[model samples]
Each structure stands twice: as structure tokens, then as C-alpha cells.
Target: MKLRSKIYLYSSVLFAVLLVIMNLAIYYIFSTLSVDNQLDRADAEAAKIAADMRRAGSEVSAPELLRAYVPIEGMLRLYAGDGSGPAPVTSAAEGELSTLKPVFYNEKHSEIIRVDGRSYAFISIPVIWVDGSVMNVQMTQSLESTMDTLGVLRLVLAGTTVFALLPLLLSSRVLSGLIMRPIVQMTATMREIKQSGKFRRLTLDETSKDELVEMGQTFNEMIALLESNYVKQEKFVSDASHELRTPLTVIESYASLLKRRGLAHPELFTESVEAIHSEAIRMKELTEQLLLLAKHHEHWNLSMKVIDLEELVRDSAKVFRNAYGREVTVKVKGEVKGYSDEAKLRQLLFIFLDNARKYSDDDIYVSLEASGQERLITVVDRGIGIPRDELPKIFDRFYRVDESRGRKQGGAGLGLSLAAEIAAAIGARLSMDSVEGAGTSVSITIAAGSGE
Candidate 1:
């Protein structure tokens, strides 16, 4: 789940729990107050009924007197003096009092009762007679209305709980998303930098004065420092390689002259001269490849314009044919026009053909086609295919699939790296799919409308 959703979920749950607790507490407090009020009212009514019973005369039947009593006159039930059974009662009858409390000065005056899930307060008052005797006058009051009110309150509380939490849930989601958006953008920018070795410019709104913006700024600074160091290092390597090439070429020429002068035996002279020449040629190729890579990396800029990729491939194929006749076969298919550097595209295409001639037999397939948003240019060679493990590293600088074999084949192993740099400069992607025994296929996919 996203961060926003998780925050909203957790906050909603917490608020719901708190709302329930608050509602329950309010219900308990209100219920207690209602019960207390009912008790006080019931006690006063009991005392009044007791006085009325005395005035009605002690000689009358207790049930009759209770009937005549006003306060306890209704909803009052009287029991026999001996506590044996209930006597005749009416709507005026009050429920039984479990204890003898009204006549005893030290006894409790009132008690609580429950009936049908409703609470009530019951009180007993002493009815004093002329003969120093007493009668119990009991009073009762129903808590039905209070219970109903409480039920309504419970519903209200539940509704209030949900209503209060809804905004918090929504706010949590919105706030979490707002907080993480900058971080997500920064993450995407860093990924682009890592993939292409290019720095991105990021702009954060002023209201977003959070830690994520600070982090983005820090990351931009780091990329700037890395780019500066990388440029300096590439320049140094290119300069050193170029400077060494001239002297090495002169040494090879002088060695060849020594052998031609017949100063040594024929076999020894030929072998020594050939070794010097081979080393010199290898050094020269290495220097050239390094210089090309340095040039592509130095500025991280490509002069792009609209170019016909099919025509560009055709021209490169003709150049290769003129240089090495009939050794490689080049085929073009479908119209592929995109924005790219014409010089760099030509160089990239030549690398494919060169690889084909170096490692494969006579048959090489070059095909260009457009699909969806991408234009794919593929170069397939029926040569000694790359191993599965080495294919991934083929585009790394100076990485050779067959290191020992590549040196003998007069390759410095920088062709694919240079091609990859060209592809990145044009916002194209390069991919190679190959199997151990199967011929390798290198595909370059440029945006349909991207180039020159």
C-alpha cells in the first residue's frame, strides 16, 4: 500500500476508537445523573404518600389506604405484614420493598431496582399510627424515558464518532501524499542520473519547504560533483592515450626498418618485427577507441536533427563495403526516421557491422523497423555468439566477451561502450539478446520522432 493510505487507515482506526470511548463515557455520566435525579424524586414522593396514609386512618386495610394515598397511590404493590403474599393493589401499587427501612431510624431509606432492562428508584416511608405502630408506604418511579433517551444518545454518539473521523481520514491521506510527492520525484531523478550518468534539474514549489526538497537539492549537488570528476578523468585518459600513440607508432616503424636492413637472421628478424608491429597496432586501436569514448563523454551534448535512419545505414554499409569488400552483408528494412546525431548514428551502425565481421561468418542481418512508439534497428550476426554471463558486461568500457580472443582479433573492446554513449545522447536505448551457441542480436530502439 502507499504511504498515504496506510496513514489514513491507522488514523481513522485511532479516531474511531477514541470517539467510541468518549461516547461511552458520556453515556455513563448521563445515566448516573438520571438515576440520582429519579432517586431524589422517588424519596420525596414516598414521604408524601406516608403522610397521606396516616391521614386516611390506620384502621383501614393497608391496601385500601394505599389506594387512597396520592404519591404511592399508583404503581404501588403492598405485601402482607408477615411478608407472606401480595395484597390487592391497583395502578397505584408500588413494587415490593425488599427491606424494612422506613420504620427503622438507622436503616437505609431507598433502594435501586431493575425491571425489563430499565432502571428505577424505590423508597419506603413510615406511616405512623395513633397506637405507636407504623405502616410502610412505598414509592416507585420508572426509568423508561431515561433509558429511551440513552438509546437515542447511543445512536447519536455512534454517528458522531463516524462523522468526526471521516475528515481526519481524508486529511491524513492528502497530507501523506503531499509530503511524499517531492521524495518520489527526487527518487525518479536519481534513477535517471544513475542510468544515464546525467544530472537533472529539479524545481520544488516554495510551499514545499520540507525535508524532501532539501534532500533533492543535496542529491543535485552530489551529481554535479560526480560529473565534474568524471569529465576530468576522461580528459586525462584521452590525453595520455593520444600522447603515447605517436611515439609507439615511430618505435614500430624504426623496428620494421631494422629487420629490413638484414642485421639479424631472417626468422628472428621477421618474428621480432611482427611482434613490435602487432603491439603498436593494438596500442593504436586502443588509443583511438579511448579518444572516441572521451569525446562522447566530455560534454554530454549531442547535436541532433531529423535524419533518415535507413539512408544513414545504407551509406555506412557502402563505406564498409569499400573498405572490406563483400566480407559483411547489410540489409535495411522499413522506413525509420528519427531525431539523432547523424555522425554518431553512422558511427553506432558501423560498430554493429564491425562486430559482425570480426566474430561471425559471412552472413550478417541488418533490419530496421518501427513499432508503436519506438523505431528498432537490429544487427544480427551468425558469429561466435556471446555467452549468457558476459552479454550484460559487453557495454561496459573495455569489457570484452572473449578477452583473449578479442585482442587477437584486433579489438580494444570499446565499440559497444561508445555505441551505448551515442544512444544515451539521443535518448535511445540499446539492448543485446544472445545465447551461448545462437547468433547475437543487438537492437537499438530510438523514440519514433526523436533525433537530429
Candidate 2:
């Protein structure tokens, strides 16, 4: 269900419950008040009848007739001591009147007396008679009028409850709609953003003063960051690809010359062929590394498993020793075990070892160790160390500390960048420490277990 409809339904039900409780309370209170008033009026009428009886000397005197009339009043009766002789005309049969007792003083009493198959309230008050015998005056009234008034009161209360609920229901719906409109609009806008692949600002009015405004502001900031990062990534890839094209073209041109000229010097041809093959290989490696880095940036899933880092470093050192004609030393200082992709981990170790060889003076120290709960792999080289200002840009694709020397050494400068990508993909931390003209130490730290 929509938020607005839910709010409306919940509020209306709550208001209706309160309304019903209030109406029921009022109905009960008014009904009690009406019943009490009827009884009080009945008591007053009975007292006046007794007073008139006291003033009259005779039982059938005219003074008794002076009693004030009461609404719903019925037959009046007079009783003497011993309770049975000379009863009034409206008195009951001898058997029924035998239940009456003598009234010696002014007192009030009541009973529900049934006669002729109907019920009546008999209100009796005591009075003093002239002959020293106590007499009682009685009057009976029907409860039909009070019951009728109670019935009408119930109808009025029900009518009031219904009328009150109408406005409550209407106001609840309006309030719910007003509160929920901004949220609904924000939801629609987010859906549009997902479908369109571009975020647009939420244009809710400033009059909305609640969490919705805060959410809109946060969404705007998030989109701004996404756009900025996307632009930076696009620029980086474009620049890296552009840099490779020139070297690739040179290699292609040399290959075409060799194919066309068909060995002019024989020895010279062999040298040219080697140069072309080396450049082609370098271009291929650079392109493949760049593509891998791009794929990593776009969220490549690297399957993680426990691998022996000590063995990986030892193997990488052997590869570099053969490839670069350098004396590489590998030391396994501790048990180096962590979760990572085996192939990618080997690729990363090779990148670091290759970079160390390309810059260092033939002696490279590669060590893998475990300390506490962390695995540390360090590649240290006593080479022409990077300058302080150039160290920060070393991880940038196609960046080099000594660009001329790097090109002379046949280096493309993407090895460290690829190493950094691999480190990030496997949840390891890669950092470097260096001193100019002395040496450089590159350290990669991987946590034990899954490296979270």
C-alpha cells in the first residue's frame, strides 16, 4: 500500500476508536443522571403526599386532595396501623395489602410492586395520624417515561459519534497526503536515476522541513562524487592508451621493413628483428596490464583462497633472476599464508620483482614473513632511489622516477601500477619507503585469514 493510504487508514481507525469510547462514556453518564433525576422527583412527590396526610384529621378529608400532581404518578393509597381496615379506593386486594407495615414517623421506602401483570415503583412515606395510629401514604409511578428518554439519548449519542468521525476521517486523509507527497516524489526520482544512468537533483520545495530534505541533500552530494570519479577514470585510461600507440607504431613499422627488405645485412637484420620482437612484446604486456587494471577498476571478482606467500615470492625471484640476468635473493622468514587468488598473487609478485630489477643494480632482496596476525612481503633494492617529490606519483599509470633511464632500460612504468591494482583487489595494503641515491623498500601487508 502507498504510504499516504496507510497513514490515513491507521489514523482514521485510531480516531474512530477514541470517538466511540468518548460517546459511550457520555451516554452512560447522561443515562445515570436521567435515572437519578427521575428517582429524586419521585421521592419529592411521595414526601408531599405524606405531609398532606398529616395535616388532615380524617382519612377521607379534602386536605389530602391538596397534594401537588407529579408526572407519571399513578394511584395513591393510605394505610393505618394493623395495615388492613378502611383502605383507600386505589388500594390493592386484602391479600396484597397485607404485606404493608404501619408508618409511625416520616420515612422513605420503595418497592417494585407488580399488579395486573405489569411492574410499578411504589414510593411510600410515613406520616402521623390524628388518632395516635401511624399512617402511610403511597404513590406508584411507571418507569416507561425514563426508559423512553434513555432510548432517545442513545440515538443522539450515536448520531453525534457518526458526525464527529466524518471530519476526523477527512482531516486524517489530508494530513497523511501532505506528509507523504515529498517521500513519494523522492522515490520516483531515485527510480528514474537508476533507469536513466544519470542522477538529477531532487527539486522538492524548501518548505519541506524534515528528513526528506536531508536525504535529498545527501543524494545530491553522492551523485557529484560519482560524476567526478567517472571523469577522472576516463581521463586516466585515455592518457595511458595514447602513450602506448607511438611505441606500438614504431614496432609495427620496423616489422614491415624486415618483412619487405628480406635480410640486407643478415646480422643487422637479426638485430632489427630482435628489437622489433622486444618492442612488440613490451606493447602487448603493457596493453594487457592496462586492460587488467581497467577491469579491476570496474569490479572484477577475484576468487580468494589460502596461498603460500613464501613459495610465491621464491618463484617470482627465480623468474626475475633469469629474465633480468641479475642475482635475486629470496628469504622466507615466517609462515606466509593468506586468502588470495593464486594466479593474481603470482602476477603481483612478478610486477614488484621486475620493477626492483629494472631500477636496482643487479642485487635485489625479496623477503616474505609473517608476524603476529599479518603477512608482510618486502622487496628492498639498493638502487638509484626515487626523489622525494617523484615518489608520490610512482603509482600513476605510465609514470616513472627516471623517464629517460626507464625508456633506455625498456621499461613501460606500468609494473608498479599493476602491482597496486593487484594489492587492492586482494585486500592488501601496499606502501613504499625510499631514500634518494641509497635504496627503496616496497612493503605489502596482508591480514591473516580473509584479509578483510
Candidate 3:
């Protein structure tokens, strides 16, 4: 069943049970009081009759005494010895009198007896005469009026219960709806989103600080993250396909040419073989970079170690100078230390220096500076600097400001992206300052290591 229905059902059942119990208690108390009031009236009349008999002594007249002292609304009887006595003061029958015989013999004091299908309260008292003879006085009051009063009271209570139930049911339904409204809306919104495959958020009530509101906020945030990741994955796939297509097309074209005429012509054969080999190497490098990017996208476990930032920079510059015969210079302020993965830091430096060398024939400057709690390492190149708008996208995979230059220099446009990932993994910040023509400087700031 729905939550609203269940709530209404349970609440109604509870209210009904409470109503029954309360009404039953009230009925029982009222009935006891009414019965006691009747018995008290009967007892009072019997006492007056006894007092009158004691005052009259042996000459007391049972008929006259009963007539004078008995209540007008009830019956009174006198039994001088074996119940062979004057007729009762009221219109009660002999059968009704016989029912009271047990009260007289058993000393029951008082009891309620049913006569002619109507209820009556009976009271008995024994009196002793001056001659030592005993007499019994019996009085009875009809319960018809009391029963009628209680009947009316029960009707009133039942009516009140019914009246109370109308509002109770309505209020229960309304309150349950109010409580479940948020959950219903959430379910509906989710169903619509599932059908349309769209990212939608719940309309929250900011004024309410309820748990439902918090849940809605969390759900919206989760969907937003999912949407962002979904868009990024789509873009990544498109870019990877585009980047892979170029080298594959080159390789295919050269292979086709070699298949057609390179075997017959030895000169064309040498050129085609070299072209094919070069394109295959480019394809292999691109695949490797793609794999590395994927690995970094997953959980990257960094083997953190304390490494000299100054020493790492000098080593990278030396390798660049020796390998490419390019002019590279290093400047260090002091023995700057950093806590990070040494191998990843070296790879990051290589990415920056390689980009610098690819675009510039001038000398590249590598420098490390120590400041307070951070070590700043910079690779500066006086190359064709990136445009202001393109600088923001330099770390994006397969994005290059100088695409033709990048492809020509065997750069797959993943170097800066990889460098950014490594820097992030090592708790460093990678930033760039570039002008259109002056120069570009890539900087990495890492936490400074202790002297220990």
C-alpha cells in the first residue's frame, strides 16, 4: 500500500481503539454512580420506617407505617414472620416478591432483580419488635429511568465518536499527504528523467531544513557530477578518434602506395618504407599516451619521496641538452627540496622542456626557487607563445595551439595534459604565463620538504 494509505489506516485504528476505551470507562463510572444513588434512596426510606416502628412499640401498624414512610416512586413490603403479611405498598407482584426471598434468607443486604423484563434495585432490612419477634422490610426502586438515562448518554457518546471520526480521517489523510509529498515528487521526477535520459534537479524548498530537502540537494549534486563525467567521456572519445585517424590515414596511404608501385621502383620503395615506419611510430606513441592518460584517470598511486627540486631540474636540463644538442640552462637559488614522486616530477619537467625545445631554437631556462613552504620550478621558452584564449586549453587532451607544429615535431598534444595530472597527483599546482610572441613560462609549485 501507499505510505499515505498506511498512515491513515493505522492512525484511524488507534483513534477508534482509544475512543472505545474512553467511552467504556465513562459508561462504567456513570452506571455505578446511578445504581448507588438508587440504593441510597431505598436505604433512607427503610431507615425512616424502622424509626417509626420503634417509636410505636408493640402497637405499630405495618400497613400504616409502610404507607407513611415508603417513597412514592418505589415499592415497600413488610413481613412480620414467615412473609404472610400485608400487601406491598406498591403494585409489585407475588412473583417479584418471591425473587426477594433469597435476599431475606441469604442476608444478601441488597440486589438488583429483573421483573417483567424490567430492572429494579431491591433492598432488605430486618427489624426486632418489643416482644422479641423479628420483622423484615423490603424496598425496591425501578431501574427504567436510570437505564433510559444511560441509553441516551451512550447514544450521545456514539454520536460524538462518529463526529470526531470525520475530522480525524480528513486530518490524517491531509497530514500523510503532506509528509509523503516530497517523496512522491522525487519518484515522479526520477521516472521522467529515466524516460527522457536528461539531467534534471529537484525543486527544493530552501526554507525547510528537513532531511528530505537535504536528500534532494545530495541527489542533485550526484546527477550534476554524473552529467559532467558523461560529457567529458564523450569529448574524450571524439578527440581520441580524431587524433588516431590522422596517423592511421598516413600509414594506410603510404602502404597503399608501396603495394601499388614501390616494389617495382626501388627508389619509391625506400621513401615509402621510411614514411610507413615514421607514421607507425607516431601511432604507437599516440596509443601509449592514450593508455597513460587512461591510467592516470583511474586511481593514481603516487610513490611519494623526498627529492631535491634543484637537482631534478638540473638533471632534466642536462639530458635535454645532451640528447637534442639544444641550448638548455638551469638556475637554482639554493638546495630546494620537495616531497613528491621523483620519477613523475622528472617526467613533468621533461614534458615542459620537450614542449619548449619543440617550438624554440633559442636557449631554454629551467629554474627552481624556494619560498617559505613551497618550491617553485619554472621552464621558460622563448618560443611562439600561445594565445591568451588557447592558454586555458593547453592542458586538455589532444588540444594544441600550434597543431601543425605539434604534429611536425612528433608531439601528440598529451604532454601538457600528462604533466598537469602528475602535478595534481603530487599535490602541486601547474600554471602557465604566456604572451603571444614574447615567451611562455610553465611553473609547478610543490610542498617544500623538511631539511631531514
lDDT of 2 at 45: 74
Model 2 weakest 10-residue run by lDDT = 89-98
Per lDDT, the best of the predicted structures is 3
**Clash tally, candidates in order:** 20, 0, 0
Candidate structures ordered by TM-score, highest first = 3, 2, 1
- What stretches of model 2 exceed 4 Å from their correct place? 1-210, 240-244, 255-276, 294-311, 331-343, 368-370, 387-414, 436-438, 448-452
Summarize candidate 2's per-residue lDDT along 1-452 as a digit string, tens digits: 97788899999999999999988998899877876676678778778766755665565553245233332335566665565434433323323432444342356687666565544567877666677766666766666577777789889989998999899999998889877766677678779879997766767567867776777777777768877787767777786776687677777787777777756646657767787778778888778877887683447667788887777777777777788789888888656687677787777777777777777775899887777778888889998888888888888777878778988887777788888888888888888988988989988888775552
Model 3 spans with C-alpha error above 4 angstroms: 1-165, 175-189, 201-218, 296-299, 450-452
Better of 1 and 2 by lDDT: 2
Residue lDDT tens for model 1, 76-129:
544324443235344523344333222233233687777555566767665555
- CA lDDT for candidate 3: 0.80
Assess each prediction's global lDDT (C-alpha) against the native: 0.70, 0.73, 0.80
Tens-digit lDDT string for candidate 3 (1-452): 98889988998888888988898899999989997887787677666766676678567677776677665556777666565666677643433544445334324267777877777887777777666667677777677888899999999989988998898888888878877877788788889989998878888999999887888888889879988998888988998888889888988898898889877887887887888888898889889878878885346667887887777888888888999999898889978889888888888888888889988879999888987888899999998888998888999887888778887888878888888888878888999999988889999998888673
Clashing pairs in 2: none
Candidate 1's displacement at residue 400, Å, is 34
Using all chains and alpha carbons, the TM-scores for the candidates as numbered come to: 0.45, 0.59, 0.66
Q: Between 1 and 2, whose TM-score is larger? A: 2
